[model samples]
Target: MMKKVRVERDKQGFWTHPQLPEWDESTTFADSKKWFSEKGLDCALVIMDGDLGEQWGNGEIDSCLAWEPEINIQDAYLVGIWDTEDGVVAMFAFPQIILEDSDKAAEFKTDISGWVSSDGRFYGKDERLARYAGSTHRKCDCGNIIPKNSYCNPCAEKRTKEKFLAMPVVAWDGASYIYDENTDKYFSNPEELVEHYAVDDLDSSSAMLIVCKPNYARQIEDDFWCDDLPEDISFDECGGVEQETISLLNKLNEKLKTTVLSYSPGDQRLDQSLLF
Candidate 1:
């Protein structure tokens, strides 16, 4: 015949074992079976106080358990059981560190029997416990508020590519290029002069040189070359070039002249040769 077991709390608010000297304070779930073996107990059961539900703010009960310092208590629940060889065991007391409210505690008491079995095991109330356990509310690394089901709004927003050509361009043969569908043309360096100046003519080989405004003697040398051409071949003289190439070079020259005039405080001699 199965023996009947009873559990009672002591004056110090700990549950007393019926047969064992005292409840093992260092017990863990992994060692529960071993604890039974050493103490000659068959099985055990756990009971939780209803009050702990309120103490776990944000509907997070698992956090309380995970954050528990002592193994004896977890989220205000009384845990541990000892079943004897004759199928009789006593309940051990292990309470959560935080206390719950009276109203919440009352609700738990009303449904305690439904949740706890006569054999000292917990059942039938896992849904409610899981609802509280799975609650997650926190901020993401990008300073965006994250909810239970999704990431932070700001983080999602930041991940989107606003620009049409958001893909990173890997430089092959020391040249980086991106195809712009808006203009139906390829930009050699989209992040530089073309984007900043809003000019479409400049290819990848455009150069910026500082020279005097009226320096006709110091002509701007056209030394820029394409990747496939030899060192002797100039950008302008390259065969099968696009019409925009000349326009871009002219614009670059205009910018260089304007920049030089702004910095040259006095009337400077214009080297005509420098304007190559």
Candidate 2:
């Protein structure tokens, strides 16, 4: 007679060998698939000893038992072969089923075990067997990957400064300008600019108002008024006035009640104007 197998179950569902830990039967099959797939193996199986199998086997005293054709035993057997080869004898009881009129079979002890089959060989529950069972796919930028939430550390600071400069302005005068919630003070030269605020502290303000000559202002927007006059405030050729320089002087005049004077290069000239 073919060796009849037995099955058994514990309060937790199934009894396994003392050395072999019990796993949730529902997730066990899915985990087995993943375990095998990661290892690039063909199939996976789980087995238990007959002593552990009695718990799952039906209590029937029969010599010949009708095996369920629907239950795929091939994969289980393949896994069993691997387990047996690995010296895990407990795996044999994994698929124990009762036979009809097998009284002696019911008396056999059944225990739980697990196994996997790959390359025509069976293997026991070894860490190496399930090491690479799953695909390691990673998502793109928006996903939960490192350094994708914002610009990298170095770029983040520069981006933050650019964004801060784009904010709307509240008010700006000849001496100081206010943007967003920060204030910036103007200085006549780079030396004065550095003296009032340290280089590192400059980033604390939203903007810096630098006073420059009209010629310099041509290239860049004038953030504040410069007390110094243009080289040729009066248009000698036009005699009457120079429209561009006069317009710039008028704007500065409106902001500050003072006279405008033309200071030639390399010439020391100082003049004061009184407003009515």
Candidate 3:
């Protein structure tokens, strides 16, 4: 098995050692530069103890502090770091390795325990290879390796809920439901809010009306409103709307009348109307 150390750029803008937080806090990249140019590093070389075996696999992994060799660090410059599940990843502008010939056996191999370098070398034990090679391992802002996307699962879910709650809605008969024709799912109404909403809230309403920018409707999935009506077809001819929905639509238009500056009766050509 190989040994790994967690490392990150500290607030002072220098990579900190995993085990020696105090030492990292005491020193900075300036010290590392001095070690390379004027003096030499006399510290114990941080080495991994295990081997990744012959099978180097797909590079995606949890974010982690990689054990970097002093030689590699000498040529490296800090670019920017992002928070990962493991910790803050100390990114470098260059010093990236380029993999050349790859062994057929190792070419398609993928592993979570180790990182693969750009040149196709497997650094199962040495995580530095993963960072240098730009592995697919995603890091959450909280500093942990997660699945492919940016936020960890927990954070992602939380964000989604927060975003949903902030969406616009309508309040009727003590229930709030916003129609999302795209997903055909109801989200909280932005226009009006209740303490909490559920599927039951939607069931309470005889009919629901979804409102979205006409042009943006298509950007959402499964929104029928996004479908362009037949050329010259008036709003009345657009079918599928319930009588209740029509009543609510009229009410909404009445409300809009107070705030809207003007309404245009554009030419029948869909393209011409859409432009404005």
Candidates ranked by lDDT, best first?
3, 1, 2
Off by over 4 Å in 2: 1-151, 169-193, 197-276
- Tally clashes: model 2: 39
lDDT of 2: 0.32
Q: Per-residue alpha-carbon lDDT of model 3 for 41-118, expressed as tens digits?
A: 222222222231111122333322343333243334433333333333343322222222222112334555555554
Report the candidate with higher lDDT, 1 versus 2.
1
Model 2: ten consecutive residues of lowest lDDT? 267-276
| Model 1 Cα lDDT, one tens digit per residue, 1-276 | 112345343432334334443545465645764555443233435433344424343344433232212333222222423322222123433311111221212132245643432223444555344333333333468755334455665565456323212433222222323333233344334344256334555442322211212222232446534556666787677666676977787777766654432221112211213222
Point out where model 3 deviates above 4 Å: 1-136, 148-151, 165-177, 180-276
Instruction: Assess every candidate by TM-score.
Output: 0.17, 0.15, 0.22
Candidate 3 TM-score versus the reference: 0.22
Candidate 2, 92-169: lDDT as tens digits: 322222122223112211232433222222234542332222112222334332211223433454665565445442
**Top lDDT: which candidate number?**
3
Highest TM-score: which candidate?
3
Error of 3 at 190 (Å): 13
